[model samples]
Structures are given as C-alpha cells and as structure tokens.
Target: MPRIFTAIEIPADVAQTLTFLRGGLPGARWIDPENYHITLRFIGDVDVHVAHDVASMLDSVNRAPFDLRLDGVASFGGRKPRSVFANVAPSQALTDLQAEHERMMQRVGLEPEGRKYTPHVTLARLRDSSSRQVADYLSERGSFRSAPFRVERFVLYSSRASTGGGPYIVEEAYPLAAIPAKRAI
Candidate 1:
C-alpha cells in the first residue's frame, strides 16, 4: 500500500519567496521549499488497485489552467497553533478542481473528506508555539502576497506515512487545458 495525494506544484520563484518566511518562531519546523504544494485531496494508504484507479481517473479531469496567489499568512489549531501556512486566494477553478478530486475519490470508494477544504501551502509544523507567538508572527507578515502564478498542471505525489510535511515524490502529473486566446473583433 502507498500513501498518496493530488496537488498543484508551486513554481520555483514562488517557493523561493515563501522561503523568506522561515525562522523566527521557536518550535517551528520549517518545511523544505521543494515540498511546498497546494494539496487537492489526500488519499491515505491504499491498495495497488485503488491507486491505479485514482491515477486513471485524475487524467479524466478537464479544466483550463488558472491563476492562483498566496494572499496572506495564518495558522491552524487556533490556541495551540499546530501549523503555519501561506494562504491561497480564493479561486473558483481551484475549488472546482478540488471538489472534482473529492468526488473522484468517493467514486473509488474512499470516505468523504471529513473537513471542509481550506486550500493552503503549509510552511511549518508547530510543536509548542503558543497562540500569542502565532499571533505576533501573523501580525508582522500577515500582508504577504505573491504575484499570481499559473497552475498548468496538478500531480499525484506519494509520501512515506509519517508525521505530515514531507519529502514527497511526484508519481504522476495531469495537465490542465491551455486557456484559449481571445479572438480580435
């Protein structure tokens, strides 16, 4: 069985920008820039057959490339601040793509994802940072935003099952349709 998930790769330039957010907070285990990604769906350990079905079904997704931006910074686990992340600006295309993946997983017999989809690229896993520490950090860098980046493809990544934030391997990639050029009137 392999642990896998679908996600949009962050461009190198954007990843470099994100790297600046490293350090400052104690107990923050910064994620490697190479592992930064906006996950579409997390499909936990599955048999070979289900993995093959997921890979095959993902190729059937039909959607045009869309732009996404990292708009702000935030943390999860309000009081305890379990993790920090770069917020992704809302995009219907992104939401639709994620929803499609959710539906596809169910079609493959996986349970519906229990949590509401909150799209973000995690920056670090907090071990003992308090709410004040997280709040102060956010206050200082809350206005961070990245230039819009085109998402031309999404990929299926496999990772060793362990605590999250990892050395993920791209098992396969699925490209989105190119946006058609406008015709001059």
Candidate 2:
C-alpha cells in the first residue's frame, strides 16, 4: 500500500525560494522544492477501496482560496534534530479548511490526526542532531517569517518510495473558490 496524505502544494515561485534556502545543514536531507506541500492530514497505506473512499470523501471539502504566509525556519528533535520545516501561518480560512478536511475524512473512515494542526511546509529532514544543537538552531532563527501568498488548491499525495526524494504523486487536486479581486485585508 502507498503511504498516502492530503496536502496543499506550494507554488513554483515559493518552491524555488525554498530550494535556494537549502544547504548549510549537515546530516540533513533537504526536500526538493518541487515536493514542498502543506499536509492537511496523513492517512497511512490502506486497501485500494479505502484510498478511493478517502478521495471521494475529500471531494466534499469546500475551501476558498486564501493567502498563506511562510515565514521563519525551525528544526525538530531538540538535541537530536530529526527534521526541519518552515512554519506556515494559519489564517482562519486555512484552519477551517483543514478542520473540514479532517472531519470529512473521518466521516469517510480515516482517523483524526489528534494533535492540533499547526500549518507548516517541511523544508528538510535531519539525519541526527543533539538536543543542544536543535535548541541552538531554533534560537538563531526563531523569528524567521515570510511574505504570504494565495492558496488556490490542495492535493492528495501518494508516497511511493523511501528514497527521501522519490515520487510523491499528486493523486488529486482540489481547487478553492477564487478570491474576489477587489477584496483587500
């Protein structure tokens, strides 16, 4: 069974910017910008029928296009940094969309993620790091922030390999309603 997850794809321009941010971190395997995404929920491998059910149920989520801000840099694993990611700011629209997605998935048979959802786009996965190292890194860049961009759609991805850079196929794309051109914050 493929490792499946629901996510929102990053735009090419944003992806390129993230790609350039890679490097300098030893023992880390950075994610290719092309693979950057905002995971709404992750549903582990399941039978073909379940995949279909998830896809169908996800079809019910109604998320309007909203802007997202990707700012700041951070790592996971405290002393032993296991991964790193760029935090995504959660606007009410973004939060509501993810909640609706999770709720719809549960109705269709996928388990809830349990933890409160904090939006972020993963930038890399660390091979190893000490707790001190992780803490130090965060302290250095904790204030990191970025300009926001419009989110037009989200996707369903299938992780087909463990290469850390293989094919994460976009099995489906769901579009949010277009934002009004005149609307301003």
Candidate 3:
C-alpha cells in the first residue's frame, strides 16, 4: 500500500522565503524547505493497483497553468494550535483544478475527502506551543507574501504512512497547458 497525494511544487526562491520564518516559536517542528508544497488532494493509503489507476486518471486532467502566491500566515486549531501554515492565496483556477481531481478520484471509487479544501503549504507542526505564542507569531509575520509563481505542473506524491508532514516522493507529474506568448509587431 502507498500513501498518495497530489500537489503543486514550490519554486526554490519562494521556499527560501518560507524558510526564514522557521524559528522563534518553541515546540514547533519546522518542515524542511525541500518538502514544501501546496497539496491538491490527500488520497490516503491505497493498493498498488489503485495507485496506478489514480496516476492514469490524473494524467487525463486538463487544465491550463495558473499563477499562485503565498500571502499570509495562519495556524490550525483555534484554541490550542496544532500547526502553522503559509496560506496559498485564493485563485479560481487552482480551485477548479483541485475540484477536477476530486471528481476524478470519485470516479475511481475512492472515498470523498472529508475536510473542506483550504489550500495551504504547512510551515511547521506545533506540539506544546501556547495560544500567546501562536498569536504573537502570527502577529509578527502576518503580512508574509511571495512573488507570484507560475504553476506549470502538478504532481502525484507518495509517502510512508506516518504522523503527517513528509518525506514525500514524486511518483508522477502532470503538466498543464502553457499560454502562448503574444507576438510583438
């Protein structure tokens, strides 16, 4: 069985910006810069045959590439925060691509994802960090923003079934259609 998911790769420069925000919050297990990615769908543990089926279906997903940005910082768990993340600024193109993946997964007989689709690149896993600490951290870096990066492709990744955060392996990649450049007179 393999734990699979779909995601967009983060450009190294943007991941570098995220890396600078890593420290200062105690009890926070920071994620590696190389592992940063915006998840499209998490398709838990599945049989090898099913994984192959998913890869085939994903290869059929047809959507144009779109620009994406990391705009702000936020934490999960309202009271006792469990983790902190870099928000993926909203884009309808991104949403539509994700929705298409959801529909494709259902066609293959997988259970529908239970969580509402909130796109974010998780920054750190919080263990014993306090509300005060979380609030202060959010306050300090609330205005975090990155240069918009073009998402030319999305990938299917596999990881060992373990406590969240990864060591994700890119099992397959699906490229999006590129926009044509305007010809100058």
What C-alpha lDDT values do all the predictions have? 0.95, 0.77, 0.93
Error of 3 at 163 (Å): 3.0
RMSD of each: 3.8, 4.8, 4.3
**Tens digit of lDDT per residue, candidate 1, span 47-66?**
99999999999988988999
TM per candidate comes to 0.95, 0.86, 0.94
Best candidate (score: lDDT): 1
Worst lDDT run of 10 residues, candidate 1, spans 173-182
lDDT of 3 by residue, 1-185 (tens): 99999999999999999998999898899999989999999898999999999999998777788999999999999889999999999899999999999998999999899999999999999999999999999999989999999999999999997776789999999999854666999
Worst 10 residues of 2 by lDDT: 129-138
lDDT of 2 by residue, 1-185 (tens): 77788888888888877766666666668788778888888887788888898888877665568888887877756556778788887588888888887887788777778887878888878776565655665576567666678888888899875866536899998888844566577
In terms of TM-score, how similar is model 1 to the real structure? Answer: 0.95
User: Which residue pairs in model 1 clash with each other?
Assistant: none
Better of 1 and 2 by TM-score: 1
| Model 3: worst 10 consecutive residues (lDDT sum) | 173-182
